[model samples]
Target chain A: MITAEQKPIDEIRNMIAPYKRILALGCGSCVAECAAGGEKETAMLASALRMAAKINGEEVIIEEKTIDRQCVNEFVIPLDDIMEKYDAVLSLGCGAGVQAVADMFPEVPVIPALNTEFMGETKDQGYWVESCIGCGDCMLYYFGGVCPLTRCAKHLLNGPCGGSMDGRCEVDPDVPCAWQLIIDRLSRFGALDRLEKIYPPKDWSKKEGCGPRKIVREDQQK
Target chain B: MNNVSRLKKVLENGEFAVTAECGPPRGADPESVVKKAKLLKNNVDSVNVTDNQTAIVRMSSLAACALIQGMGLDSVLQMVVRDRNRIALQSDILGASALGIRNLLCLSGDHQSFGNQGQAKGVFDLDSIQFVRVAKNMRDEKVILGGDPLSSPPDMFIGATANPFADPIQFRAVRLAKKIEAGADFIQTQCIYNLDRFETWLNMLRERGLTEKTFILGGVTPLKSPGMAKYMNNKVAGIDVPEELIKRMEGVPKDKQRKEGINICVETILRLKEMPGVKGVHIMAIEWEEAVGEIVERSGLLPRPSFD
Candidate 1:
């Protein structure tokens, strides 16, 4: 899941300052699961904005609406009728959702209300940890299912550097050293010998330097 | 024979080698590097010029090594993976060779948060081991990464670092073996204050027959004061200065602590010389290069071997 946190209320308020009438849009997907942007959050944000506007002696009209999966074009069709009623759409969604909403309604400006963090897992209640970097090429099998490229602070492949102490990273004491986890897991499976062979340099072109990555499935595209 | 590096020749000749570090100045001053190199000249086998050590911006290691070479000393160009990608790393390897640098120390440098630039983006495109393999291929295989042939390869005696005191202590030697297997011609360890733990790590290397594969240089740093000892033990990531050694430094008078520190360093170097797999001692004087000559002389490692 993509985890995100709502931007500061002041910043969001300023972004919507240019528009007298605005629509606070929300996505009921990843942002909703993270408790960042959903129907409940949208209502709360709208109420807060109204109160702030009143205190500032500004006469502004704000409306709230949430749709299922704002990134999908089919789910965004419901907003096409009412989008023209506002000067701008405050998108309480991930980056992709904001872009998708903007693509759907060309007249109304789509502004992000939440800062998209990373592709992560809900480790515990109110605790999220990054798990993937979407490197396109995966070598989790050799590393006992732990992704060194994503987890390691240095993204070290061969082994732990001289910095791993007390099973923690030198970069951050809180973060566990990825190589320690790799070694421990490989040792448990008696596969520690797998690390003997030196892993070569990563092919970063497959990751993201050249341009925006795209997938073209010929059968599904039409 | 593989390269013209004096350190390689000393180690290959089965003679105990000695190397010390020379950190570049914060500003663009080449004279500071020259002064440090001159102090270490004829006192050590090779001088390691650190690259943005502790993530603080300083003169580049390549430029410093070139300066040291100008002082008529063999230089080990310390390249860290934290700042440069593979392309820059490979390009610098060739450039260093062109400037007469013979040895290379590939390191995963200290994290940027530890340095002046805490917000700097760390460029770890290739880790230390990968850098070693890359340098070795550029030297032995006469090719760059992706097997592209170079017009001329960098003549380098590849080196890497090991921390015997780091956590999951049992796996420390295994990591060292991986580096040796990755074509690290030499291994320089994190500073050793806990001799027992270092011996255990060295024994692990011996058990795996890694002792015979590559030269191992134990690291030693002369503590300037008791506070310095405590700081290293508590703050430094991989270093573990034993409490007893700290007490030894504290026991000495304020004016005599520096002398006591040199005594302790000499003792550590002597112990390292007697160890089976330990081939040499790398004295990282850490901005106190003036004390290196005294420490080396007291350790009875004088009349430093010269291949010229």
Candidate 2:
């Protein structure tokens, strides 16, 4: 599950205070699993807003709607008609979904109610921690199952720095040292010898320093 | 004592308290919510604004609490740590306190798998017990993340949840005790339909001498119909509807089932009120707010204690 945290209600209210007709749009995808943006959350948000408006003596019209996948164009196309009914949309989807809604309905304003924190998995029932950064590359094969891109504060690809103390990151004591985790995993897999194979510095060209990256499968092309 | 301490005194006075749970709407229209709040304001002692009840998105809980406060009604802002980190949670608590929303319910909400969005991620930075402890720490220390002294520590009535009917009732009680030990001032249990089982659990509390440590609020929700009962039992975990109640609901005429449901809820509340260690009632009408007033009235719980 992608761990997501909801934006403060007062901040959300202030953002949409000017709008009379509002649509609380939920994405039935990542945000849904994280319990941040989904159909149920949409209804709950609607109910809370209705109560808030009543107490504030504000005349606001709110509607609730959810899409299968707000990040995809096909999923968002159907929302155009519904978009016409509301003055603004409060999306419970991730940043991608919110952008998709905005892209599809440029005429209507779209606001994100959740801060799309990071791509993560639920460690337990309600617990989730960051795991991947989708850097268009997978280095877990060399290290371990853990991705240094997300776990390490510096996103180091090599060994742990001197800042590591007792296997904990110096930046945040609560956070475990990512490189230490890598070493442990490598040792468990009997691949500790791989550590001697010094890796060259990462090439920034294939990553974020450059403009947006795209991948095309030659076989899938017409 | 401060305002919050005063509220705590009110609760400790053995007053017949009434609390209503308000689920925010999915969209922006606040009419239905406002109507529900208006209807509940005069009848209940405090109104609970749920935060993403059932993991569904709606209006924000903080905004709803602020709105309820603006209407001059006591608002209990429900906070679910499922989607927030410790920093965010503490920050929100401070913000809520600044907004004059003193009452808070710390919950580890339902898993995302229960909702329509099954693949969404969950952020359980801390469980209910950890959250309650954090709240207590904040109150006692008056310092946040950077060790900066708070301008004014928030005086909040920290609340937690317990489900008496949850499978392995012993574990549930243990968890409840942990929450209390973690600094839960009060506990609001899950909806109850089986009074005998609930009473047995209450007896257990008495046996363990936990009755005096925490204020227990019995949860009551009126079944709108047989379908509603089935949905809750089959779909919602830790919620059980007795076969006899189901049969009674099924036996009732379709048009009158809602009335019967209200009656059942009222009877349960009346029974629970008479039981030992039950501080008050937390009425969860689920989408049927109109019936709450009727249930409270019929249960003879009207004209509740005035804090003023």
Isolated chain A TM-score, each model: 0.96, 0.92
The sequence of per-residue lDDT tens digits that candidate 2 reaches over residues B24-45 is: 8888877766877998977887
Error of 1 at B235 (Å): 1.2
Model 2 misplacement above 4 A: A1-222, B1-9, B145-148
lDDT, candidate 1, A61-95, per-residue tens: 99999998989999998887887789999999999
Q: Report residue B16 deviation for candidate 1 (angstroms).
A: 1.3
The model with the greatest TM-score is: 1
What is the DockQ score of candidate 2, to 2 decimals? 0.02
TM-score (chain B) of candidate 1: 0.98
What lDDT score is found at residue A103 in candidate 1?
A: 93
True lDDT of residue B4, candidate 1: 82
lDDT of 2 by residue, A26-141 (tens): 88888888888889988898889889999999999988988889888999898766676899999988888888889988889998898889888887877789998776667788
* CAPRI quality of model 2: incorrect
Off by over 4 Å in 1: B1-3
Worst 10 residues of 1 chain B by lDDT: B1-10
